[model samples]
Target: MSSASFSEQSSDDPALDRIGPALSRLRRRTPASSKDLSRNLVLNVIADAPGETTVGGLAAEMGVAQPVASRTVAACIAEGLLRRTASQSDGRRTVLELTEHGETERSRFAAEQRRAFEEITATWSSEEQIQFACLLDRYGADATAWSRRQAASRD
Candidate 1:
């Protein structure tokens, strides 16, 4: 990677520092925990889902361990971010969905992410914006693929 690309990957980059600080500030301002955020997002998905959302499926989709998903789902149930009920189609299945409050938090989180992305993209030229977006998307997919490969190796 060129120095520009290296800068793009650098956590020490001033732009990243700014974004990090902003996120940190937002986290402190909100009554959200890592588990809460994860569960809230999952609940949002489940609400729109057409079928029962299993712990294992949520784990796979969220790229987390099944236990983590189960615990988060359980916690969300406690926090009222989600509700669980027996699946009518399958007595052994668990149904999950976002509560009203969870929908609010999900909306808030999405808005914050959009605002941050907008802020970062605002400084780029149109061509740079398109290239940067493509680069970022590739980076995300590559990172996910690499992580899954690493996890499989560990197993």
Candidate 2:
């Protein structure tokens, strides 16, 4: 993986030092599904969206180009994991919906991820695990907010 350099100077925080390496490892690890990470992510993004998901919305959520998202969506559709339909609110607009197969696959991937987390933290106490999970969820939320802020500033 490439170096994650925020600046010429390094941070004094020990956790910050380990974070880049940990994230790199997580990206390299594959899920228990036959689908690649991108496809799995498509299912996840669509399923988790607050409202109907369009191709443009998927691209934004994934932080990818529209064409890249479209291709991935096409692949998922061809595989019977997703379906495209006209938006109920707007006849001309299209939305993405996960098929039953996609839901099943998504559930499988999530279960595998949880299993891996359990295995890795097996030595930790149950309380410690719960605490870590809560902190991690908070971190993810904060990261997403930070990312969106950065993007908006760029725009």
Best by TM-score: 2
Error of 2 at 115 (Å): 1.2
Report lDDT (CA) for all predictions. 0.71, 0.86
Which regions of candidate 1 are displaced past 4 Å? Answer: 1-37, 44-50, 125-155
Give the per-residue lDDT digits (tens) of candidate 2, residues 40-147: 789988997777999998999898999999999999999989999999999899999999999998888888888988998999999999999899889877877787
What value does the lDDT take at residue 41 in candidate 1? 60
Model 2: worst 10 consecutive residues (lDDT sum): 1-10
Candidate 2 lDDT for residue 27: 64
TM-score of 2: 0.81
lDDT of 2 at 13: 58
Q: Cα lDDT of model 2 overall?
A: 0.86
